[model samples]
Target: MARALPQPRRASLRRLYDPQSGEELDQALVLWFPGPASATGEDLAELHLHGGRAVVAAIETALGNVKGLRPATAGEFTQRALMNGRIDLTQAEGLGELLSAETEAARRAAVHASEGGIRKKVEQWNDRLLNVSASVEAELDHSDEEDVAAVIGSGLSYRRDCIALAEELERALASPSVERLNEGIRIVLAGPPNSGKSSLINAMTGRDVAIVSAIAGTTRDRIEMAVTRRGYSYILTDTAGLATKTDDPIEAIGIERARQALDAADAILWLGDENPDIASDASIILIHARCDEPERDATPDDRTPVSSKTGAGLSVLWEKIEELASRHIPAESAVFFNERQRRLITEWKNRLEAAAQEEDLLLVGEQLRLARSLCDQITGRAGVEAMLGDIFARFCIGK
Candidate 1:
């Protein structure tokens, strides 16, 4: 412990001693910040001690005997920051994401959020909403005093503003969700039996995740592997071959699961010679696999011919995959919302849209207020008690 508190916000090297026994302790650098201006909007101190268990334990022991001194619990510092208005809920969530980010894209997106990208957007939306709300309130206040024609004209303008704000929210919602970004784009390999689907997956991932074999139905279940390719994340799935018919019960189950995977895929790598028959919104890439083998049929003009065994055409396939993936990946600088944030914003947008459509000024006003409340929850201004614990629990101690 320091003999005296260091100059505010300045790290000072100091000698340490045990107050109870007057024994010399390790030298350390300490910095102090007075209340209301620090990270938590309260007095704060940092001790940069030598990184050793004994050193930390000694400091903890000395501090433990002091009145009202204890270690922070999980996310306590950040929770306090939120409670004290040092940072909003979105930033806290972003910090959590930053801690767990695995890929470069995830890290960049998390950095944007942690730096108040989403909060600033919410603030702008809130300002616009308040402007529209003010108009609605004014109309309500002067309904009898104002000319009927003038009231109608101004009301139209206010509703237009509401619609514009709703459209903005709609565009934000249309962007790929943060969960999808974190979980990676779902790329499912679907084709007939012995069509080199397994080999293609192993080639794409640069590892043998799925069992490749000449026998049909070797992959009896879905084999999911998350991989990062060229700074983008992808969840590559090698599914059981979609055979025309099956008598075995387990293989049948796997075939059914393969069909399900097709439905959920963001991109399909179809290794079969024929065109895919499944009805899906996912991008389908026709592939002519085993191109290096003798007596192989002519490669179709529309299909991407590839040889997983020799690594031929893998670069072109990767380029095509990356091209499709780029459409789903949001720009690093762009602001995107997580599931909770998106849900709140969606409700807020719905309220705004309803307000724009409603003919009754009173109803419009109510909708505007509800929308504002949702914005509040987005920034942790109100009505977030139930989710606070869940959010904070994501962070470890000393966050």
Candidate 2:
């Protein structure tokens, strides 16, 4: 009897060689996973073959003959990982975000989430909530024997702490800036003619993305470009100059479009040569254009002087933009960003705040429970299989 060589360990790609030839021939790559360390906590196997119709057909034929082997369905591997406690639902979402992230900020956010930032926060909140619930239960159980005042006082203190935690959560969840940062902030450039709106756009993006001209109303349509500053992506829009008494239909249409852009923008860079004043309902940042020229008599609140031609004060403008973005958006601690998370968090916050205001202990307990359940949904601990499927289905199959 001839001794057999030990089988090579399987991997993402493997090679099978002809036994007799000892020369280069057909190959089959194998993938194998042992239990516990595997994503599914079970044995797994895969086969890869050389690129050729005949080779693939041979491998498939061999695999079909094997018992208990089947093609993996989309998300089956990730779903198994979830079921086996290898990863949580938030991690799954993070994976999707990681795949789709087009900017550095978005990628960082996804990496933070995948590293358990969101899950850790949710767990902390849940732990606090559980403690509060236990204390409430204790008070309710011993209501008769203890001094009623003492029991009530202790319950009140616990309620206050719980209410404070809920308020903090609400603030975090209410942050729209974090979502905007991840999704790309919309910054609209608006000013009167010859205010350097186009120049500023070019300077910020480090490219001639817009047409710059000495004449007024050169830009009659809205132009958008993606600008990355400090690892954040901003969808910067340079709209036609906003001015009065334009009879041209195209100019009128451009003005209307500018107004619409301002309304939808997260921030406005209002350029001005004389006064730095531009009226708008949007959050405005006053920028004194033509800073290369000598300082003229002008008084504008929080005005930043910028010279796009020489790059003067551009750094300050970028910093100001970052500051405004941070102020409007949530930090990394925010638990809600998308519509689903926002709706759930808002509903829970409303109920919890109402209970905190009420004197009824039973109602307070119920409200706290509801709030915990909502947090549970964020962490996927509340049995959200259907929602998980929908969320993961949006991702590519490999993830």
Candidate 3:
């Protein structure tokens, strides 16, 4: 510990010493932030010590020996900040994203969110909803009074405002989800046995992640490889060849999983001669594989002919894949919601829509109140005790 608390909010040169042993531990820079304005909204101290494992260990030992001193657990500081209203759930989520962000785009987006991008938008929605709720309350309380009735005007305006807010939030959902950005776009490569699906995936990713073989049903499961290209992220999935009649149980399971992958795919490269019977809304690109062979060089009207052996037409395939992915890639400044936030916001939007449609003032008021409570949950102001453990668990210690 320092001999004296460093000048408030300023870093000061200090000699750290072991409290019990009275031995100088290190010469370091220390900072002091007095209560109510610190990062955690509590009195805080910062130690800037030399980059040495022994130094940190000694300091830890010293602090451990002190009464009432203990190491902060994972996300403890950030949780304290949230509890004290220094930051909300969204910002805390953003900080977690920032810490784990692997790509430049993800980092930039996380930075924006961590700096209150989503919070500002939510605050605006809250204010507008509050105004609408107030108007509804005024009408319900004073419908008998002539002047108040005139000002309220049959409550059409507030209803319209509620509808408009709902529509706005609906549009906001069009932005790319945080999960998509974090997990990368799901791109599945699928086709009949020995249709060069494995070769193509290995070529696309420049890594031999799948076994290349002439034998049928070699791939008995999905092989996934994460790829980042042109500042966009993609998960290239090579699935077991879809055989019409397979007796092996493992191959059958693989084929079934391939179909499931198609269901979840953002885009599919169907490397088969015949058109695939895909039911999902995923973008399916018919692929003419082994185009380097003279007989298979003729590409159909919509099919992209690619030969992984010679790396022929791979760039074109990438262009098409990138084009499909670009539609879901959000702008850096755009607001993004994770799965939980999106669900809550969707519920809030639905509540607002219900308020807009309801004829009964009491029901409308109830809907508006529920909408407000959803906003509270989104911001971690209420009803998030069950979620705290899981959320903070994502964060590293002392964040």
Candidate 4:
């Protein structure tokens, strides 16, 4: 049997918390509001609580005891806010992100989003789409009196605007790189054995994280650590060195994993002791490691010279990392992040392309509707109960 918890209490008007503990207790109470003066045009009850484990648990117990009050799901409060016209969909998503943000860049991005950056754009597109839908409906209704060409021309103009908006949405979704910005940037270090990869990791993180040894193949696995550089979070992965011949099976596996890391990384620090003959790969920033070595002359035009021993060029390396991190910032217009958003945006793009190529009014209307729905999905304006639940379920119970 599940344990019963207390119901959450309502705070008093003009004051939120009692002076007993200088903390608000989570308990059930009711206060009256004579409304032509309410914020939402309705009498509102404010809930205040002590942000403590026991207090929240007690509140939940109290709420469970009550008949009407249920625990708010992920975005439920925001959903209610939206329904009450307190905020739009974009602002809701932004608030969600803001609550989860761990870095300065992410916080800024979330704030920008919550301020209706995406909402305004989405609303503009929706307005254009609504116009197109109206024109199509008018054509369908007044086909008897209206000239077919004139109606078609009007519909075409609106369709063109819809198509343009779709294209703009697609570009915004792709350009912002929102997922990477929301989550920390992924950066991996790769090089041949004994090229100071572990040392570099330690240097960049300002900690002696990995086992630093002169022995080749010292690091036999992908060692990952979180680092904050210039107030931005980054997942820096130090992978095993890439080498062809290794006697140990473990070392061989580590090498394979290193290759996979390189393939999967957002940016790769291709380290080398001396200038090794290696082709430049996309998304790779070549780094000449062990600059302290007297004999080694590894220096490429694009490669930054770094010495983990004396901490030389580390500042420059951080600058490089920051530069790469900036590329993934989520812009105001971009709302896409997960697979759902991607699929919807792709569908929208496909429909827009189809509408541009085809002259069928019905087909165009259908595509526009699909595009609008997809845009709605981006802001959780459309049916998103399941998604909202999933997103909120991932949060802590009291969040």
Candidate 5:
């Protein structure tokens, strides 16, 4: 009627069996963790078993038969950890961010949060604002009505401090570093009809991601591929060749899509050395297609002439493109990798700005409180119940 408790931390050989049939399921290493040191600040056990379907299914079936033992729900263990105060909301959000990270830059940013990068900064801001609030509160509590000018002076000093913090937040949120890291750098291939835009993307990716053809409008749809070059992720898009007039409706739609892609691009590979007059701050690398073709200038001073057929200038092109991608990746900044974090940060910044401008000390303190609440939301504290269902639901069972 009793089970032996396995040694803590060290894995012990154990055999799992089906209770109904008394059949040995499989041998696995069972490790037991007890008490406050455990991840959830409670007793936890881990069963290290072979991966795959049949083995896992057998073990799961056996576990279900045991009295008073059941399977964990999605994110249950992590949720337990959260409830136990083992990790804060920022770290919990970071865990979610790390789970969904698709790129190296994104993974690194998420790691920063999980390692308390965000919490540290938020706590620092919290301290500063609390100190400011306390200063204002102290003046309000003071009995001396004679020194009215002194209170105004103290208020002015507090306003200056708030202004400084607001500007700092402004600069941090102004740069789209988080968005760039999360979305990856978009590099679009755009050019005139039969200008080898598709061919260039295929060559750049070193894969047949796009169809290359001599026909003017063969590529009637946009093809996109995410590629990692030099430890950086880039989204390479091959669009239908731009043409002033097209009789085919599909081709016209593709061309319009191409324009949209270019507009959204972080960097554009303008094939055939022609500017399409698109308004974008994105880097435009004029690429001259078919350098090996006859009746083409081999040396264009402004454009990078590349022959996809011969693999000319591709190496240099990648280096140039990576340089552009790196510009989007910032160093030493508090990055918000998801839309939720971005929105919360934006709200925090706006509230801080409003707090600085409020004439009444009580209103200014309230604004700071509201701003801190926004920061709290970003890190997963207040206003979390509304989002927990959606966020934790994404995690698989036993997480």
Candidate 6:
């Protein structure tokens, strides 16, 4: 490796000429990073090579011939980073999330976690837990005034802190904003046939993603388009019109699918002049679509009037949906965006809650140790060797 460098210890451009075959593979700028400062806390180098496949293949083949040289598997570099304390488990996973992020909201959350924000919070919790554990362990060892006071004091503080943390965990588990960033918030367009559901969806996305037809039951299935509104991803679905007593098998199937879509939606845009009195717990924007060409008994206060063709009241309906989504998530939350993180954190929180109720100092100390172990698992301080391959497999090669 030293002989291949253009200079002894400094980064510089170098040309790769095969020693045995006398063939020049490529020229590249290379930087040799010494141990303890690199991403993996070991000696590493960055070879900024040209992306030509032949050049890359030749280099790889040449290196493969060396006794100790080998190719990196997917996310192997990141796993090395985790193993060497260069980055914790959350930050390592965050790197994967950042690479896969599909929306601005998702990117924001991923970047935050990747940059050690979650690690900082976890460190604070570990410090507090350690203090409580020490206090409990002391109480277990002896029965004295000082030990009793320490136990009582630590228990009170731990109770207050654990309750706060539990509340935060519960809120994070329930919030839709963070989870929807990946799955995408589903907003179903539902109403009678020829009620302009397709046209409204097209207008919302500013693209003709759904077929706009005047014929009833023309759209026989859910036509979903990924719509980005204010940087949040939404699956805007235009479904078959809902009505009773459909003799056509296909139309009936479409209606059943539409009902299924509505059932799964985060919000419903009930578009029509007639209110069908459907039972739903979801937030709905009752939109009297096609108001520009309308005949009805009276426009209800609960339902907004809009026309996709004329672009009337559409902005107001959009505002309503945006507001609903924004209100669902907090401005700043210590939320775990993925299920794996949520599950581990929830386990830790549950242990803390259980430990809070135990009166015996030895039992309480054991529970706290178990709770700390869960946090250790969350940060990959313990018990993660088996899953390392699975975790890093999602990453790109050489990362």
TM-score of each: 0.95, 0.79, 0.91, 0.76, 0.88, 0.87
Model 3 / residue 114 / CA error / Å: 1.4
Weakest 10 consecutive residues of candidate 3 by summed lDDT: 325-334
Which lDDT tens digits does candidate 5 get at residues 268-326?
88885556677888889888778888877566788887888899888888888877766
* TM-score rank order: 1, 3, 5, 6, 2, 4
Point out where model 6 deviates above 4 Å.
Answer: 1-10, 146-161, 176-179, 244-252, 274-276, 294-302, 329-335
Q: Cα lDDT for residue 248, model 6?
A: 96
Name the candidate that leads on lDDT. 3
Cα lDDT of model 1 by residue, 1-399, tens digit: 436799999999987778788777789999999989999999999889999999989988988888998888889899999999999999999999888887777888888999999999999999999988887887788767658547655565777899899999999999877766778989999999989999988988888898978889899999999988777899999999999999989999999999999999999999887788899999998999999988665788999989999998999998998888888885454887899999999999999989989999899999999999999999999988899899888899979
lDDT of each: 0.89, 0.73, 0.89, 0.69, 0.79, 0.79
Instruction: Please list the Cα RMSD from the true structure of every candidate, rounded to 1 decimal place.
Output: 1.9, 4.7, 2.4, 6.5, 3.0, 3.2
Model 6 worst lDDT run, 10 consecutive residues: 1-10
lDDT of 6 by residue, 1-399 (tens): 236544434779878766557678788888887778888888888778899898888888877877888889899888888999999998998898888888777788778889987677777778878877776666666556775766566565556666676676576567653455766777899998888899999888889888887788989999999877776677889999997779999999999999999888888998866675667766788998777775742567888878788898888998898876665543344544566667877887888788778777677778888988977887888898887888799999968
- On residues 100-209, what C-alpha lDDT tens digit does candidate 4 reach at each position? 77777767767777788767766776677777777776676676775865766655575576668777767766654445565577788888998789999998888988
**Candidate 1 global lDDT:** 0.89
Q: Tell me model 2's lDDT, rounded to 2 decimals.
A: 0.73
CA deviation > 4 Å runs, candidate 4: 1-42, 47-76, 134-163, 176-178, 273-281, 297-302, 330-342, 394-399
User: Is candidate 1 or 3 superior in TM-score?
Assistant: 1
For model 6 the local lDDT of residue 286 reads 91
> Per the 3 Å backbone cut-off, how many clashing residue pairs does candidate 6 have?
0
For model 3, residues 52-132, the per-residue Cα lDDT tens digits are 999999999999999999999999999999899999999999998898887666887788889999888899999999989
Q: Is candidate 2 or candidate 3 better by TM-score?
A: 3
